[model samples]
Target: MIEDPQGTVLALFAAFCRVGGCFMLLPGFSSARLPMQIRLFLAVAISMAILPLLWDTIYPRAADPVASYVRLIVFETLTGAVIGLIARYFVLGLQFAGTVLTMMIGFNAPPSPDVIEDTAENQLTNLISFAALMVLFLLDFHHVILRALVESYTTMPLGAGFNPQGALITLADTLKQTFDIMLRLASPFIVYGLLFNIAVGLVNKLAPQIPIYFISLPFLICGGLFLVYFGISSMLEIFAAAFIPVFEGR
Candidate 1:
C-alpha cells in the first residue's frame, strides 16, 4: 500500500531537523537538568507527529538530490534555530532582569544550584526566573510556540533557505520588547534601591562614628523582601500576559 517509503523516511528526517533544532534550545526542555535521551525522543516524536500534516510540503523536497538535501538540512535547522532563539532570548531577558533586581535590592545571597538548569544562581534570582518560567508553563506557552512553529512553514516555507539579516532583526526586536517589559516590572525596585541608598548615605555622612552602611543592610533586605512579597504576583501576571504578544509580534 505504501509507495515511496524512502521519501517518507527522508521527509520525516527533514521535519526532525527543524523540530529538533527548536527543542535543542527551548527553555524548560533544553535545561541541563533534563536528560538528553528524553529531549531527543521528544524531538523525534514531535517531528513524526508533525510530518503527516506537512507531508506534501516536505516530501517533494525530501527527494532532492543528496547535495541539495544536505543544503536543505542546514537551512531547515537554521530556520528552526532562529525561531527557537527568539523565545529563548525573551526568557533570558527575564533572567537578566532577575539578576539586576537582586543586585538592586541588595539581596546578594550566595548562589545555589538552579532549579531548572545546572548553573549556580543567586537564590532570589533563581526564584524570580523559575517562577516566571513556571507561570509560562502553567499558561501553556509551549503550545503557543509550537503553534507558531507549525504556522511558520507558510511564512518560511520548506527549502526557501535561511535569511540571516531577517533572523537578526527578529532577535533584536525580541530583545527590545523583552527589555522594555522587564524594565517596567523591575523599575519600582530600582527606584527603591536608589532612594534608600541615597538616604542611607546622607545619614551616614551626618553620623560619622556610626557604621550606618552595615546597620542599613537589614533594613534594605527587609524593605526589598517586603516589596517582593506584595509585588511578585502582579509581576508574574504581567509577564504571563505579555508573552503572547511578544512572541507573535516577533
Candidate 2:
C-alpha cells in the first residue's frame, strides 16, 4: 500500500549515507576491533530509527532526479565524515597526550597493536587511549553524537552544497583546540622530565666516573609512574567532559 516506494528507498539510502559515513570514522564504534559487518548493520539500524524524524526533509530531496540523488549522497557522506572526525580528533588527542607522557617519563615499551587503530603504539599509549575511550562509552557519548547529528539538519540541511573551505577551517580549529588540551594535560610530565634530566646531567658532570644517568633512570621512571597514577583519573575526567562541548562546537 506504499505510494512512491522508490522515493522512500532513496531517502533511506540517503540517510544511510550520512549515518554510515559517520560510523566509519567514529572513535569507539569505528575501532579496528569491531567487525565491518557489525558497524554497517549498526549504521543501518540507526539510520532507520531516525528516518521518520528526517522524512520530510530527506524524502522530497530524494524524489529529485537520479543525478541529484547522487550529488546528495556525496554531500551527505562528506558532512557526516566531517562531523565524525570532529569527535575522532578529540579522542585522538588522548593518544597524543599518552605518547608525550611516555616519552617524558622515559617509558619506552615496545610498540604493540592498538585496540582502536590498526597501527602499532606504545603500550602506555595504548592503555591510556583505551581507558579514555572506555570512559567516554560509559558516559554514553554515542547518544550525544546522535543528538548532534539530528540537530545538524538545521545548520546543514539536505542538498546543501558542500563547502570544503568551511570544513577545512573547522578541522583546523579542532586540531588546535585538541592539541592545546593535550599539551596542558601533558605539561606536568614535560616539566618533570626537563628538570629531572637537567639534574641528572649535573650529577653526571660532577662525577664523570659514576654512571649517574643509568642510576637515575629507575628513579625517573618510578616518579613518572607515580605522577600518572595520581593524575590519570583527573585527566580522563577532563577529556570525557570536553567531548560533547568540543564536538558540538560549543
Candidate 3:
C-alpha cells in the first residue's frame, strides 16, 4: 500500500508543472489544432510515467511549506519552458525560413490558416512548415526531447530558483544560432530572387512597352516551384539533422 499519499500527490504535481509547462510550448504537441484537454492529459500521463525515476529528487522537495511549494512550482514551470523554447525556437526558425523562401520565389498567394498556429500564413510556407514538422515526428524528435527532459534534473535540480538571466542568455543564443541556420537555408532562394528580378528589370528598361513584369510573373512562379521540387528533399534533410543537436544543447 502507499505510505504517503499526500507526498506522492505533491510530487506528481511538481513533475507535472515542469512536464506540462514543456508540453505547453512544445512544437507539434502545442499546436492550436490540438485540444487543450488532450495536451493536459498527455502531460499528466508522461509525468506519471517519469515520476518514479525522479522520486528521490522531487518527493523530498515536495515536503516544503505551501508557500515554498508554490515557489518551486513556478521555478519548475520556468525551467521546463526554457527547455521547451529551446526546441521551439528552431521550429520557428524553419517557419521563418519558409516565409523568406515564399517571398523570394515570388509566390504571393493569399494567406491561409496555419496548421499549427491560429494565424494565417502563405500556402507554400504552411506546406513547408507542415512537411518539416511531419518529418521530425517521423524521426521521433519528441522522444529525443523527452529524454532530454529526464536528464534536465541534473542540470536544473529542484529547489534551485528560476534563473532569468541564464534563461534569457540561453534563449538569445538559441535564436542567434537558429536565425543563422535559417538564413543559410534560405540563401539560395535569396540569390535566385535577386538575380531573377535584376534580369527582369533590365528587360523592362530595354522594352518599356513590353510589360515584362507581367510577362515574367509566370516564369518566376514556375521557376520557384521547380526549385522547391528539386531542393526540398535536401532542405528538409538538413533541417531534420540539425534539430536534435540544437535541441539537446550540443
- C-alpha lDDT score of every prediction, in listed order: 0.89, 0.89, 0.91
Residue 149 lDDT in model 1? Answer: 80
- Candidate 2 residue-wise lDDT, 9-76, digit = tens: 99899989889888989998998889989999999999999999988988888778745777888999
Ranking by lDDT: 3, 2, 1
Regions of model 2 farther than 4 Å from truth: none
TM-score of every prediction relative to native: 0.97, 0.97, 0.97
Task: List ranges where model 3 is wrong by over 4 Å.
Answer: none
Q: Which candidate number would show the highest lDDT if scored against the true structure?
A: 3
Q: Which ten residues in a row have the lowest lDDT in candidate 2?
A: 61-70
Please give me the total number of clashing residue pairs in predicted model 1.
Answer: 0
Q: Candidate 1: list runs displaced more than 4 Å.
A: none
Error of 1 at 123 (Å): 0.4
Put down candidate 1 lDDT per residue, 1-250, tens digits, no spaces.
7698888888998998989889888889899989999999999999988888888888887877654888899999998888788888888888888888888889998899998888899999888889999999999999998898888899998988899999999999999999999999899899999999999999988998999978999999899999999999998999889889989997
